[model samples]
Target chain A: MEIKLLTEHYDKKEFRFIEGYKKLGGYETLKKAFSLKPEEIINEVKASGLRGRGGAGFPTGVKWSFLPQNGEKRYLLCNADEGEPGTFKDRLMMERAPHQLIEGMIISAYAINSPKSYIYVRGEYNYPIKVLEKALQEAYDAGYLGKNILGSGFDHDMDIYRGAGAYICGEETGMISSLEGKKGQPKLKPPFPAIKGYLGQPTIVNNVETLAAVKYIIRDGAEAYRKYGTEKSAGTKLFSVSGNVNKPGTYEVPLGYPLMDLINNECGGMKNGAKLKAVIPGGSSAPILTAEEVQKTTMDYECLAQMGSMLGSGAVIVMDDSNCMVDMLKVTLHFYHHESCGQCTPCREGTGWIHKIVSSIVNGEGRLQDIDLLEKIAQQMMGRTICALSDAAAMPTLGFITKFKDEFEFFVREGRSKVKEVRAHA
Target chain B: MFKLSDEGINFVKKELARYETKRSAIIPCLYRVQKENDGWVSPESVSYLSELMELPEAWINEVLNFYTMFNKKPVGKLHVQVCNNISCCMLGARELTDHLCKTFNVKPEEISEDGKITISKVECLGSCDTAPMMQINDDYHENLTPGSAEKIIKGMLNGN
Candidate 1:
């Protein structure tokens, strides 16, 4: 069954506008939130146990607490740059319910006491940006945003910052750099964003879903909010189901929902009645899962982590027996190679090296040793770069090689796919 | 010699002031340049934007080169970007890309001979649920077949 906590009103076309949203009990939570003390609000969020949905699975309240209490100016940045392949839930959230995100941001800002905030959307999402800009204007006119919001004496200004295009910009520091009008590259952490970020001020960057969930946590008490999800991974999350699925779209389910139920029920099972071969439970960076492994998998932080995969960004990309794993890996590797920011040597060189090796294998020029070489290169790339992108590239490379070793070895040995009758592109 | 229209200049000005930092305005300003310069940002436009925004040329160029959306060279009026990432590829996006290129008589990343369209295979465009999709200019055409995509392109190519 769908949990629909955040997406309950998504089907209503009028929900996009402030007036329509208000008709459906929207922004009432913001008012309720404003009535509570800021510290109380923070405490409530901490009690709710909402983790960062931006793939890190970091506890959201803990992240807000990291901001130095020196009364220094801090920034709340909404990570709307949904560049993770197979993930479109954020885009859907912004497009269908911009004000929901806006309300959530304002409440988060009020709790964090940040005077200013930004929604850094990807450049390709021009349509969603347009919707947000209009919704922002409506929010301003309605006094939900801007100075002295709702006369609560908490002054906050929210704006949408368009990212030019790098996938790396999805990284918090990379987004901060882009917001500062520089190359979208991730900076080294130590001070982290809480200590020094976005023009050297304390900044709290949260995923769109994480921020939006703040409203519900405030609306329904922390205890009520905690009831839907698992003990650690509390509350509902929007899983973006894509690839060889019959009904692929964004589905909001409780954190510990069964992956197989989501596929069989929500997604209407594999497309064209093909047998499920594999799945990438999270976004592109998550390790791949075999059909048997996915059967026992639950969509949560602990379950996926225990299974050697992750519930990263909740982008479930399904693949059937019709697809070739090697070809899929080639495409996936090419994306990392193309999008690598080239700042860190391990990610810069390693992404290209692994992509080249995979390309060679796909091109039928692979030696048997190339498979081991990929594993070695990927192992070195992990935990070596300034950001997880090195690991993002390596994780899948390692996952594909280890779990689907037969595909790589067969491709190296036979120069064509063992599953599909047609050969992959030369 | 590259200059934005008065309207374009005004949009850039507003965007510069819209953000906490003027540098944040660079992406929006470059998008304006792309629109004004027929779909791509030129070197002259980069220098012009740098001078206009009072930012470094390096800063402007980095922002421009970093984003795939801000095309560096001229693109056809109809810039057909086929999504060939994992989900889309699983749903015949590559075949769609091939069909588009063949129908237009062009190679991937190359403009058609008549210069009406450019077919480029792109990564995921975030519409994977509606797989085998393409972003032609600003609109996303998803769940497309070779025939349907061809029809859409023909309509756009003929200005219909």
Candidate 2:
């Protein structure tokens, strides 16, 4: 069943604007948050068990606790850069409920004692940015923002930063670099963003969905919020279901929902009654699951992780039997190659080499040895970079070849795709 | 030779002071430059912006080159960007792109002879449910068939 804790009013057109949102009981949480101590709000969030809705799945409350008590200037960044393939939930969230996000950010900012925050959105999101801009002005005009917001004596300021076309900027540190007016490249860890980030200040970066969930955590209290999801993965998640499903759209379900039930009950099963072949349970970077594995799978951080795949951004891409695995791998590789920041060598070269190998196979010049070469290159690419771009490229490459070796070998030997009559390489 | 209008200059000045550090304004300033100068940024404008912002040419150039939204060369009046990522590809986005190129009589990434349209295959625009979609300038045209996409482009050309 769909749980609409954060997305209850998403369907209402008035939810997008301040007048509509307030009528629907919006910004009520901000008033509630003001009545409590900052630490009290943090404790409530800690008790809520709300994990990061972004790919990393870090604990939201734990991330906030990392800020040093010594009063240093702090920054709160909202990662609105939703670039992962097969994911469009953030786009929907921003478009439907901009003030919802704004309210959440203000509350989060108060908990962390930060005065300034930026919602770093991707440049391709022209429509979302415009909607957010209008909503932000309304927020400021209504005094939901600016000095002593809601008469709580907690002053906060928020702005929007647009990123040019780079997928690497979705990484937290890379986002910090882009906000700093530099090339969007991922910085090294051990000086994590919570400790020192965004112009060498203690920064907390949360995804659009994760920050939006904060308002609910404060409103419903921690115990009520934990009732929906499992012990570890508490609360509902918005999954962007695409590719071959009859109902290909965003659906919000409680955590630990059965993977098959979402497809059969919610998505109306496969389009045109096609048989399911493979599923990328997370985003494209996650390892693909065979149809059999997807049957027993449940959508949660722990279940997907135990299956050697992580619940990354909750982008469930369903592939029916008619799709060619070789063709799909080529398209996936091309994206990583194009988006690799080149700051790390393994990703830069490995992504290119793997993409070229797949392209050659699709073009009917692949050798049998090329299959093994793909695996060898992918294995070396993992854990050898500043960010997971290398590993992101490597994981799916490894997943496709290991699970669907027959398709690759047949393409190499027969010089054509096994599923389609004509070549589909672009 | 490439100079901002008085209003564009003032917009850049406001952006310069928008963020904590002056260097953070480069992204927004480059966006302003792209808007005023056709649909892309030019090399001459880099020098012009450097002089106007009192920043190094290298710093501005690095930022301009790093991001993909800032087109380096001139594009047509209508920049048609088709999503060719995995989800869209599965839904015949490649065929859609080929269909648009043939109908418009232009190659990918090249401006038409009439200079009104340029079709480029890009990565995902995050609209997977509405696969086979295209973004023309600032607006997105989603859930398209080949016939529908061509019709929409024709409508825009006729100033609808």
Candidate 3:
């Protein structure tokens, strides 16, 4: 893997500081980028084929290309509001290399001609916000952000906007609402954030990882950047692996890397001798995979899709036989219900209804018909909304209920969780 | 004034530091004070935040009034934050949340009398593995059962 292009100075605590950042060649790539034409940089990104690291996997270059050709005081918004469940890599990126994101943003803003930029961070990331705010002040002092950035004559100002702990705000449009000081809810589409966003200007909302990698994209030409990963999914990706593992932390692997290697080598395998049961390759939004399927999969956008799952936010949640799918599904459903933002009715109500059905099954009050009811509620919730939050909520529920129905039914028939209670019953 | 914790005071100072031009730290500062004051940003604290952000009382008041996260009303001593996100929802957090409200004898977001307990539904707590988790005043109790919920509440009441 590319040791620390994104996580280059992770071992260095000083990298979190401004002086340390400059010493380690931070903003050097930005200086190189400013010399080249903005369109050239965007084209390079497109050619590289780097997808959005935040769940949706939208084409990063294409998202940038959506900006209007004419300059109208555009905005560059960094989606650091990493509120996805099972994801902490963004938080680590922000905390460990705050200046890297700042430098990347400056480069990206320069390319997009966005005079103003904001990093919408999660409120609970109080420390990283402090780290970033500190870094911004340093960037301003260095003239990397404010008037005449790096003598390139590009005037850009960057700020950190804290989100009030809402998961939906992680959505690009939802972030614009929060940045505009409105309730963090997704707006109707047709005017994606690229066309209309953040006070109705041409705004480009890129994920933290996507923006941070821009420096590397500029430093190494598109050909150089595509050297590591598969042709379609170029560049290294960071996977935040958590749950039921001996080593639960963030590890960077090239796209198309073996999923089994990630679990066994990077994570030190499952805790104890317990056999692997299932895997959630992405955040809670992605479908759960049985152990056999996870081994056959690779860590990337296309590979995951082929496996009937997604490489969402790269939050790898590994589960052993000790865990209960029924108990887990209930948790996933409950999160979607709480964070639905009440903007879309189906997501708002359907999430709660699904949670009710799942919990009833878990609590042993479920009826046989409720399993079908779960599928119906999920089907109605999908593709019938303004944003994909509904789909994110529904797809996982459908996957769990359909894949592990026996465990769920077993829980319903017996008033106890199958995984936990079955051992006692034995 | 004398009652704010260090965090609340820091929030006020953070807000007040913006006295030059309307500070952006006002709402978060007020939130900090409310957080310290057992989930109620008092009128006095609002005034303090207003002066800090250099914003008018009307603007500060709207911020205080808006969003359920910033509690203007007094929260109960035992603050319970139930995960209502998709994962937790699929896991049955709603039923347990409803169960909590019934058992506590209070509506969602309501702080019970005598300051014994309060319950509210909140965004995902990120602990999806132990779905159906609740954050009680800061400590997260995951994989909740009604019986376990009752036991925990009883223990909290008995000062356990």
Candidate 4:
């Protein structure tokens, strides 16, 4: 069953406007949030067991609690740079319910006692940026923003910073760097964003969905929110289903929902009644799951992690049998190669090298030894970068090569994609 | 020689004051420059912006070069960016790009002879559900077939 905690009003076009949102009880949560003490609000979030929805799955309350106790300037950054290959939920949330994200950010800013926040959206999101700009104006005109919001004597301001075409900016530190007018590169993490970030003050970067969910957490209280999801991964999550699924869009089900159920029930099964071959249960960075393994898998952090994959940004890309694994890896690696910041040697070089190897193989010039070389290079790239982008490139390279070795070997020997040949013959 | 217009200069000034530090205005300011300078940033504009913004040329150039959105070269009026990432590729995005390139009589990343259309393959634009999509200038046209994509580009060329 779909649990519409955050996406309940998403279907309504009126939800995009402030008056419509208010009619549907939009900023009421902000009012509810202000009534509670900041500490109480943090505690409520802590009790809810809500984790970051932006790929990392970190505990939201724990991250908020990391700020220094003394009164110092702080910053809240909402990571709306949703660039993962198969992820599109954040864009939908922002486009459909701009006020929902704004309301959530205001409440979260109040809980953390930060005076300022910025939604670092990707540059290509021209439509969402326009919507947010109009929504921000509405928020200010209605006095939901600016000084003494809602007469609680709390002052908060929000702005939207557009990111140019860099995927690394989705990283928390990379976002802060970009917001500060730099090249959007990820910073070293010993002094994590919680301790020192965004102009060297305490900073908290949450995903769009994570910040939006804060409104619901305050509205329903912690215990009620926890009632939906499992013990570790609590609350509903929006999974962006794409590729060969009959219906490909964002679906919000509670955590621990079966992956098959999401595919079979929500997405209406494989497109054209095609046979399922593989699934990238998370985003592109996650290791791929065979159709057999996907049967027992659930859509929670722990379950996916145990299966050597992750519920990354809750992006589920379904693949039918007609697709070629080697060709798919080529496309995936090409993205990483282009997006690598080149700040770190391992990722900068490894992404390019792997991409070249895959391209060479796709061109029917592969030595069987090249497959093993791909694995060796991928294994070396992991855990040796300033960001997980190195690993992001490496993980999928390893996943596709290992899980679908037979297809690769056949391609190398026959000098053409096995799946393409089968489709051609059929 | 590349200079922002009066309105463009005023927009830059406002952006400079919008952020905490004037340096934070680089991204938005560069975007404005690209818009005023025919869809791409030129080398001379970096120097012009450096002088105007009172920031170093290296600071402006570094930002302009680091991000892909700021085109380093001149492009067609309609910059048609086709998403050829994983999902789009599975839905025949590569074939779509090929078809557009052949029909438009321009290579990928090259402007058409009339300076109207430039077709380039891009990564995901986060609209995979509507796979095989393309972005022309600032707007996205999704769920595209080769014929439909060609029609949209041609329609734009005809000023429709």
Candidate 5:
């Protein structure tokens, strides 16, 4: 069943504006949040067990607690750069509920005592950026943002920084680098964002969904918010379902919702009743799951992880039987190659190398040894980069080659895709 | 002699101050240049934006080249970009892109003979729900068949 917490007002077009959102009793949580002490709000979220809805799945409250105890000016960045392939839920939330995000950010900023925040949105989302800009203006006018918000004396300033199409910028430090007017590249950790980020200031970077959910946590209190999802993965999540599904779109469900049920109940079953072959349960970076494995899987961080996959960004890409695994890997590798920031040697070279080998296989130039060679190259690429882009490229390559080795071997021997009706290449 | 319009320059000025640092405004300013110019950022406009924003020329150029949205060269009036990534291609995005290219009598990333359209197969635009979608400039034409996509392009060619 669809448990619409953050997305309840999405169907209402008026919810985009402050007046409509206010009519739906929006920002009431912010007013209520102001009454509690900052530590109390932090403790409430900590007890709620709301994990980061971004790919990482870290506890949001625990991440906030990492902020230094001193009154050093910190930054709260909302990672709205939704560039992960197959992920579009963040775009929907921002387009439909900009104020919800802004209100949530204010409460988070108040809890962390950070005076400044930025929503680093992707540039291609021109419409969403315009929505957020207008909503920020509305927030300022209504006294929800800016100095002395609601006369609570918790001053804050929020702004939107547009990201210009580099996928790596979705990473928090990469986002911080982009916001600081540099190339969108990831920085070394240990002096993590909480310690040093974005012009050497302590920063708290949260995904758009993670920040927006804070409102609900504040509204219903921690216990009520934790009621929907599993014990560890509490609260509802929005899954961006696409590919061969009959109804391909965003659906909100509890964390432990069955992956098969999401397909049958929400997506209206497979398109044209095609049989499911494989599924990329997370975004492109995650490992692929076979049809049999997907049937037993749930949409939580722990369940997918135990299955040797991840619930990355909750982008469930469904592939039907007619699709060729070799062709799909080629397309996916091409994306990572194009988006690799070229800062890390492993990612910069490994992604291109993988794309070349995969493209050659698709173009009918693969040796039998090249199959294992692809896996060897992909294995070395993992955990060797400044960022996970290397691993992102490597993980999917490993998943595709291992799970669908038959399709790949068939292509290598016949020089034509076994599944594709016509020759896709040559 | 590449330059922004008076209004475009003014918008760039406001964007410079819109962010915490002037360098952060490079993306928005480059977007303004792409909008003012014929849908692409020329080499000279990099220098022009460098001077206008008062940021380093290398910095402006780095950001311009890093992003796919800021076209480095000229595109057609109707810059049709089809999302041929995994999700879209699984359905019919590749076939749609091929059909569009054949209809326009141009290869991918090339302008037609009449220069009315340019088709390029791009990465995903996050609109995976509506597969086989194309972004013609700022607007999206989703859930497309070959015939429907052709009709939309022809309508554009006929000044619709």
Candidate 6:
């Protein structure tokens, strides 16, 4: 069953502002959450089995549990820097429902005993950042954010820190480095943000969607929340569906909902007479699934993982028959190359090499063995970096070349993109 | 004893005065610096900042180098950044970029001779629902088509 719980008020344009947000029973959840014990709040989230919606699908409560009890100046950071290819749900959440996220962050910060919170937004998010900043000012005026929020004896300071437009900052630790006024690059683990983070203090980073969902989790209780979505992946998730779809926008669906239902019922089907070609199940980082595999797939972490892909960042990229896989691969490789951040050597060099090889192939430099080189290089790049960014680059490269080898071969043998060149007249 | 604007130099001095024990105001310093010398990061400002913030000049070099928002090179009167990241990339940002280049008679990386438009690729603009986006000056134009691109360029050209 698809639960439009969080997105219930999205269609209302007034929800973009404060008064409209308040009218929709927006910050009421924080009042409810405040009455409950903070530990009870964490337990409720844990019971719901809500995984991190920001790609990794890690247990959110487990992540909260990782925060050290050492009385350090803990921080709650919201990853609003939605940079994943095809993932726009977070942006929509921020723009349409700013107060919801603010209320959620305050509740979560109170629960985690964090006194300072920052929403590390992408520098490019002009409207959402404005909306969030405006919402923050309103919250501060309402006595919800600064110096003893709601007079619950909780002191939390909130600010919106603009990222200088780095995709790597979407990573939690990388966000911390950026918030601490450093370059937006991912720091190594061992002393994760939970330990030595953001000026050497314990920090708990959650996605904007994840933090917002916490409000719902606390309001409805775990059981009621579990009424929607699957038992393992409870609650509704906002998926930004794009590519060749008739209705391309954000849709709120339950975790275990079938992919076909989402495509046919929600998206209004593909354009023209084009049949489904492939689907990048979750963002660009997830492995590409053929049309047949998409039919068999359920939109969840376990199912996607079983299918050798992931439910990353909840972006469903639907490709149609007219799309050329090889050309898309060239674009994807180019993006990874441009966003490599030059942090680790493997990602720094591998992204460039893969891009060069792919560009050469797309530009009609045919090499029979270049296909195999792509797979081998992608394999070597996996898990050999400071963050999963290297693997994110590798996953799509391997998926594209392996899933659509002939199209790549055709591109190399011919001088132009097989699909684009063929459809030039059409 | 060079003078930026009244508000601009005061902003810089305010930031410069706060970091008394140090001379590396690469970041807090640049906020005011950007207000003074348009949006572009001037090399001389950064050099002066390094001495004021008590940090090495390399610190300024690194901050200016790290982020795309900090334009180390000179830009046109209005710097136009077309977001070519994933969401916008899929939503025909490449076409918008191409259109801007053609209209301005420049490339994606090149600026027009009129010192009006400097087109470049930026990361995600964070407005995914309204994709195919670009930022002219500081305002964002979203859900853009080729015609919209032309209209925006025309508006900027006419100082609208």
Per-residue lDDT of model 3, residues A20-82, tens digit only: 888998878988998899899899888888889888888899999988878576889899888
Residue-level error in angstroms, candidate 5, position A57: 0.9
What's the TM for model 1? 0.98
- Compose the digit string of candidate 3's lDDT tens values, residues B61-131: 65455455666678887888886654455445677888878777888887787787878877755555566
Listed per model, the TM-scores of chain A against the true chain A are: 0.98, 0.99, 0.97, 0.98, 0.98, 0.96
Which has the better TM-score: candidate 2, or candidate 3?
A: 2
Q: Flag clash pairs in model 6.
A: A55-A313, B22-B53, B22-B54, B23-B52, B23-B53, B23-B54, B24-B53, B24-B54
Model 2 fnat value: 0.78
**Tens digit per residue, CA lDDT, model 4, A163-215:** 99999999999998889888989999879988899999999999999999998
Per-residue alpha-carbon lDDT of candidate 1 for residues A1-426, written as tens digits (9 for 90 to 100):
898889999999999999899999989999998899988999999999999998899998888988888888899999999989999999999999999999999999999999999999998888999999999999999998878877899999988888877899999999999899889999999879999999999999999999999999999989999999899889999999998888999999999999999999999988889999999999999999999999999999999999998999999999888878888888999999999999989999999999999989887898999999999999999898899998999999999999999999998999877777444541
lDDT digits (tens) for residues B1-160 of candidate 4: 8889999999999999998889899999999999999999998999899999999999898899899899999899999999989999899898889899999899999989988888899999999999989999999999999999999988989983
lDDT of 5 at A6: 94
Candidate ordering by DockQ (highest first): 2, 1, 5, 4, 6, 3
Best by lDDT: 2
Kindly list the interface RMSD, in angstroms, of each predicted candidate in the order they appear. Answer: 1.5, 1.1, 6.4, 3.8, 1.7, 4.4
Worst 10 residues of 4 chain A by lDDT: A417-426
Model 5, runs deviating above 4 Å? A422-426
Could you give the C-alpha RMSD of every candidate to the true structure, in order shown?
1.2, 1.1, 5.8, 1.9, 1.4, 3.0
Clashing pairs in 1: none
Clashing pairs in 2: none
Q: Identify the CAPRI category of the predicted complex in candidate 6.
A: acceptable
How well does each candidate superpose onto the true structure, as a TM-score?
0.98, 0.99, 0.83, 0.98, 0.98, 0.93
**Better candidate by DockQ, 4 or 5:** 5
DockQ leader: 2
- Please give the interface root mean square deviation for model 5, in Å: 1.7
Candidate 4: CAPRI quality band = medium
